[model samples]
Target: MIWPLDGASSDVVFNTWSHFSLSLNLEAASFTRYITPTKVEQKVRHLVIEWIRNEIVRHIPDAEVLVFGSTPVDMYLPSGDIDLVVQSKSLAVEGPPRSNITRIADILRSTDMALGEVRIFASAKIPILKFVSRHGKFSIDISVNVSNGVAAASIIRDFIRDIPGVKPLSLIVKCFLRSRDANEVYRGGLSSYLVVCMVIYFFQTHKGMRKSHTDPSSSLGNLLLEFLQLFGYDFNYLQSGISLRDGGKTFSRSERHWIYRPSQPRLCIEDPQNTQLDAGAGIHDIRRIQMLFIHAYDQLQAEIQRRDRSRSKALLLEGNSLLQIIMGVPLNVSATGPRWIAIDKANARKSSIGSILPCSIPQGDSIDY
Candidate 1:
């Protein structure tokens, strides 16, 4: 429970930011603990990877299956997709051959490893086979001969190691956007990688935060508040673009030759590895996203003020905590452990894949690579 039941209040006074900060810190820590994969879950992931590898190899002996993305970097949310890259001498850099993708899809469909339909997006810029695991515990995206995801994973790992507040902050932001249904790149929202880069940029560019020696863990509340403030109202998305290269800097969009599409108004996050690519290009509703951030910041501030006023009167106010007001409900971990709600289950789109036969790949369905 993120907050006490209605009509309940703490026995102690809550008149300062410290009290609210403490609550935020506790909630962040609790959420992190609940979302971090347990040893058993890790083992299951590994087993699934190995099973896929073995299945692929049985047909294409030279193919290599490699885990990438958040899974490799220990930054994944509970329901996050596992990204796998299949490398083979025969596969093209653009993507795997259609025949190969179809073959792999067939293999996956024949086995019980895949829970629902094995969807092969052969026409996608980077063709992929997407499916849910048989246990319904994981969603997996497999791309062939595409090394970019693997490379991006390595970069994220470096950021996690070198940056002070990358891990926890990223986790929190991921959950925040996910709860709002704005974390999927295919759905005009931000991807997990884009979310991470935004956090890294926040850490690198904020002078007060950069110069402070405060332990990130102890100051998560303040950091999160400031982060919302920065992105919500301060960032000039029309002129400024986020970049992680050269230790992080915000470049002028015009100077970078990145056009500002007023109609779409997407966040511009330059790909550190690929200078020409805009990591946030997929997002079509940047204004709405920023408005969401602003609302979260305002709601948190209001909660703090309300609590302070209530405490001044020696009244115990019962309601959602600061974090809960913004992030909605705290995830409920089932007693059975692995089965848990990664976000608010009521609003989340349930995976359609579930012990069903392979659906025909849509030739016209495609997404940016």
Candidate 2:
């Protein structure tokens, strides 16, 4: 069962996020070395690796299991969890295995090892093996799958590792994209991959980049474009609203809008100029409402002037009030706005002045509201 620990922690200080250690010696080249695994990490990884190697030998002798990630060597797997991929040419394709939980529990019980409380679940979609440790309740996930036509793991792993500066570039871009999404909307509707792609495209055509901006991380931007074209979804819709599961519990989604648009967003780390350009674009949609209002007012004003009788003017205003109401601004404020023949709106702004009705056009439009 899921625990009710939502909002249990106190609010983190605003400065806490900004307090990352600054090392003058750090270079983009040094990022690879900076990510050295901790001691606990080393112990947990070695323990899992040894147990798996032994288990495969004992349980299914002569069967070779493909071992990679942290186990085979000190590879920097971002998941931080020890990932072991097992080849399955025969037997059953499975998710995390429940029996592996019992097997792990039995193994840990006899040994004086620090690791504890192993759990395995077999579902069709995810890793076939999962191990849980008592210390910090740390866990490692292992997936077992048959070799498809393409070994996607090797392809991605090789590309990042072999390419110069790819990992650092990717890490920087990932952090920036995630931060932008969080500040833009507390939860993100678009995937991180999509955000990365958008930023890359903005920079690729940006023209003012330094020579160092040549990492393979730009490929993610390409992947994102392909995905968007293949699956048509409005990019702007991602800014609308997002929902998240809290404390492993579900609830109906809710939204909070930013009442004011940012003049210049500091969170966008891609092309600073492009972000400013887009903000103007988002605000310019109001110009359409301007034109719609003007056209409506011109036509409505002429119609009212043609009909000298004021008694039936109110009926005409009510009939064509849709454009103003939809735009949430008064019709007289718009081009198609009504003007009262007798009401002088210019004098209405005075402290002790004219009628409450604005004098833009057809006098009857005010009654529709």
Candidate 3:
């Protein structure tokens, strides 16, 4: 269903694809603009960061708090959590002392800054203190001496700067995976870093894309279709592994010893910086995720065919219903700005001081397109 039927004329096929492509391009633009953080939201985030930094430094004098993950690169979604790494020379080589983490949690709970009960997972591979900021309502995950996360953020930032379509495409893909509860690594879904690597690899290895003179940014609709087709139907998960090193490469999973247990055939993606590590090793439900991509592609193709049969230029120009459906964005959602802005307005009316704070719209809302 990814391509036109054999009996379809060339002109008809071209027209159908062209119309769908244009619709997708418009949808992607509108969605990006709507989800992008406003200036006021950015200020609130800064204030939250500073408040947390001061609190941590007050208790642990030598501790230096650093921001990492999506916030620095401006690629985060509206509902994204904040990632902070606390580093100090006084801390043990293994990690911060358990007493320090517990003390930090206690201090946060006693303060007005922490919105809810602070949870500390001291036994985790990388122990972390998790809490929500009362100021911006942003979820914060704090880890000690995790330098690798900081390095990964810098690398992803460079990729976004050099690649034309990475930002928008990544945002869309993140939203898609998040809606299905398949974007959290701990929950057996791909992490944001893994998702970005997949996208970069797709751009690098696509044969038609490399040869075409047209800029990939201009043809995101077609590129999205092809991306889904490649990963959903064509990718050989059992044998092949994705790599972004040396521009991009596909290697045999067995050769690299990246293969999972025989009972579980999962996706393998080698960390560009660390050959020994497989970034996608955590994705245990990759098969279901792949099938979701296939279903989304089929749904989009069906919508295109339906429009083609109707011969409705108005439908094509108005918006892309299938794209919205796949992204879990409601057809009625405004393209002018995020839905949180309206929620903030309501919150401002209820508060004694007329102040607006950023809020997250719950994802996975049913789409009635």
| Residues 1-369 of candidate 1: C-alpha lDDT, one tens digit per residue | 332212133322333333555766665665555555555455445555666777788777888888888888767776778898888885554343676677778888988888878999989887788998875357888877778888888888888898868988988888788778888877766788888899999999878767887778777777888889999999988888888988788888888878756444558999978989998876777888899899999988887776666554332333244665576544242222212343422112233322122233222222121
Clashing pairs in 3: none
Candidate 3 lowest-lDDT run of ten: 1-10
Show model 1 residue runs off by greater than 4 Å.
Answer: 1-18, 92-96, 260-264, 312-320, 330-369
Higher-lDDT candidate among 2 and 3?
3
Clashing pairs in 1: 115-355, 116-354
Report, for all candidates in order, the number of backbone clashes: 2, 21, 0
Q: Which of candidates 2 and 3 is the stronger one according to TM-score? A: 3
Candidates 1 and 2 compared: the better one by TM-score is: 1
Q: Write the per-residue lDDT of candidate 3 for residues 1-369, one digit (tens) a residue.
A: 111112222112223445665666555554555455655455556556767777778777888888888877777776678898888876654345575677667767877777878999999877789987776677899887778888888888888776767777777788778777788988877788888888888878878766776656566766778878888998888889998887788898898877668756678988866778988887888898898789878877787777767867666455335566675556545432233433432332233211422222122222110
RMSD in angstroms, all models? 7.9, 27.6, 9.1
CA shift of 116, model 3, Å: 1.3
lDDT of 2 by residue, 1-369 (tens): 000012132121212221111110122123223233334344444444554545554554543455443333333322234555555433243323444434434544554323554455554344355565333233555555444202423433444454433344444333323322321221422222223333333333333332345543323323222322322332222232211112011111112332234442211121122321222222323223223324433443444344334434453433323212222345344221222201212111121212222232223322110
lDDT of 3: 0.69
Query: Per-prediction TM-score, please?
Result: 0.82, 0.36, 0.82
Least accurate 10 contiguous residues by lDDT in model 2: 18-27
Name the best candidate (by lDDT): 1
